[model samples]
Target: MDITPVANPALDPVQFPRLEEVEYLPVSTKYRGMRLALWGGVQLLVLAICLTPYLIYKFGGEESMATMSAWYWPVGIQAVFSLLWFLEEWKGFPRRGYAVRERDITYRTGWLFRSTTTVPFGMIQHSELSQGPVSRKLGLNHLKLFTAGGSGNLRIAGLEDDEAQALRAIIEARTRR
Candidate 1:
């Protein structure tokens, strides 16, 4: 049996559709609120933990004022960090979006270091929908797609429950074919 090498041809890049040109749909508006709430809750929890030592020192009737003063540093640092984190989430909310094409699903995120991920239906092994307690209360769901080799798994968060269901169904149908 003789195997003949086929001629390799150069394709024009201009003919292909640009990802930037795709009209991505913004995630649910409630997503921003949900994220903010979640972040606030986490920050509060950490702040409470950090303050425990100081609270113990104060309540235990310790005489060392310096020890209690040192605890303020952690709390102050956390306040600054939390402020920046909240600001990033608020400002970057607009940048999170997704686009579903006939062949693939794309999710774009990030404000400073932007990232876009595309997963073709052919490569998707399965898709799942998940919701955290806060997201569930906010009527939001996260769609996660697992690829064949486990390398291209993608999670698109902040989708409305209905939208996530529809996308999952579409992916299920396409993968069946």
Candidate 2:
């Protein structure tokens, strides 16, 4: 998994350095599909809500249903957004993984459309270890690295606590020096 800059003169020396070998961190694959299921359930609930007014109009009351059906466009848009989110997550989260290289880190994600993003240690401003409720139950922690950019925070999730700590130290050491 090593990406070397030894033969590529065009690559920046500070960014690529002379990588030895890149190491992939351990990640949970068991719950990879859960996200999609959860999102789908939420979307279905919304769909039911959206159709409730129409159902009422057809049976319970005409004016009442028409008043509620005013939300048709908004609810329809929400359903479409939910569907897109589900599709994106279903195709992305399962394929997500990270690799630590000598001078930078790379994350590969997405299902139908894959993306590989590399973040050099030099650009990392700081980092943190975080765990959500589910992650805490699984004893998993994520390493979140912040860069100079306002929205470029990199998160490497589903790592062991010790691994997260070690990665934090490595990133700090590399960035501070």
Candidate 3:
């Protein structure tokens, strides 16, 4: 995929106008931040679990507990490394985002290894918006664009209902073929 930055700084703040057919799409920073926060929290929990042994041993006594405590530091360090991996994945997400432009539907998605597959309007079998607990809490919904391909479905998350439904209708109408 040929990835190019917009030379025009004006479009930097808002949407970057589609120039030509590109391989990948750009991701929103807001989503990136959320993912980072979520993963970081997870990492913190893992770290805590690893440190519990030592805290228990240190607070408890030298009575048959210090031996278990020796494993704590190693586990904590492993958790830190695991967290780093997650952070790397989160960071790479933005770069994996992509936009699809064709005679059918125009779709965009995140940069990380996510499902941003686009189906031409004609390929769409049906469309709908679904909300999970996390999504509803965040006032976000996922618009699923289904095609005959079944397993290779395309979904756009973090969209308002109006926009999702509108896009769904448009695709359904256009791709009635």
Candidate 4:
């Protein structure tokens, strides 16, 4: 494999210097509470969906019992998955956070498949702040950074409005410099 350095006039240089250890900043604690409530509500919905067929079979007709019995395995699978999701969400909340350094910003997330992404200031094309309906209700905003790589990019959610703005400012300053 031949790898040579070639300069592109269109692209900026200094895509991040050597990485070193930096203190990570944690996201809002409120988000964990939100996760618990959201996943609990989801499990409740799953419970309803999983049980509906059995209830109908019990009340609707005796012949449909076989059909309902067949659904038991699928229901059991979803229940187990819901349980896993609940546990992962509970355990993963604290693991999520972002760290800003001199040359780049890094974000860490996920439970089962953990990922840590570092986006250099020069590679960052833009940053966006967004709030969905649920997030707005919960008083949280997301700071999404765009770079040359399109997917699996950096997005730090569960930030308070002021904190998100501050982080955005830091990123913008880095990009500008």
Q: Please, what is the whole-model Cα lDDT of each candidate in the order they appear?
A: 0.90, 0.73, 0.62, 0.83
- Give candidate 4 regions above 4 Å deviation: 1-21, 63-65
Please identify model 2 stretches exceeding 4 Å from their true place: 1-26, 30-34, 61-87
- Judged by whole-model lDDT over C-alpha atoms, candidate 4 comes out at 0.83
**Residue 153 miss distance in model 1 (angstroms):** 0.8
- Please report, as a residue range, the 10-residue window in candidate 3 with the lowest summed lDDT: 107-116
Of 3 and 4, which scores higher on lDDT? 4
How large an RMSD does model 1 have? Answer: 2.5
| Residue ranges of candidate 3 with Cα displaced over 4 Å | 1-20, 23-28, 63-82, 96-100, 104-116
Model 4 lDDT tens row, 24-79: 78899878887788778988898888888788877887647578788789788998
Q: Give one clash count per candidate, in the order shown.
A: 0, 1, 6, 0
Evaluated against the true structure, the overall lDDT of model 1 is 0.90
Candidates by lDDT, descending order: 1, 4, 2, 3
Sort by TM-score, top down from the best: 1, 4, 2, 3
Q: What lDDT does candidate 4 reach at residue 116?
A: 85
Candidate 4 Cα RMSD after full superposition onto the native fold (Å): 6.3
- Where does candidate 3 clash, by residue pair? 25-97, 25-98, 93-112, 96-111, 97-110, 97-111
Per-residue lDDT for 1-177 in model 1, tens only? 999999999999999999999999999999888778778999999999999999999999884879988999999999999988877787777989999899999999877557899999999998889988888988999999999999899999988988889989988998996
Q: Please give the TM-score that candidate 4 achieves against the real structure.
A: 0.81
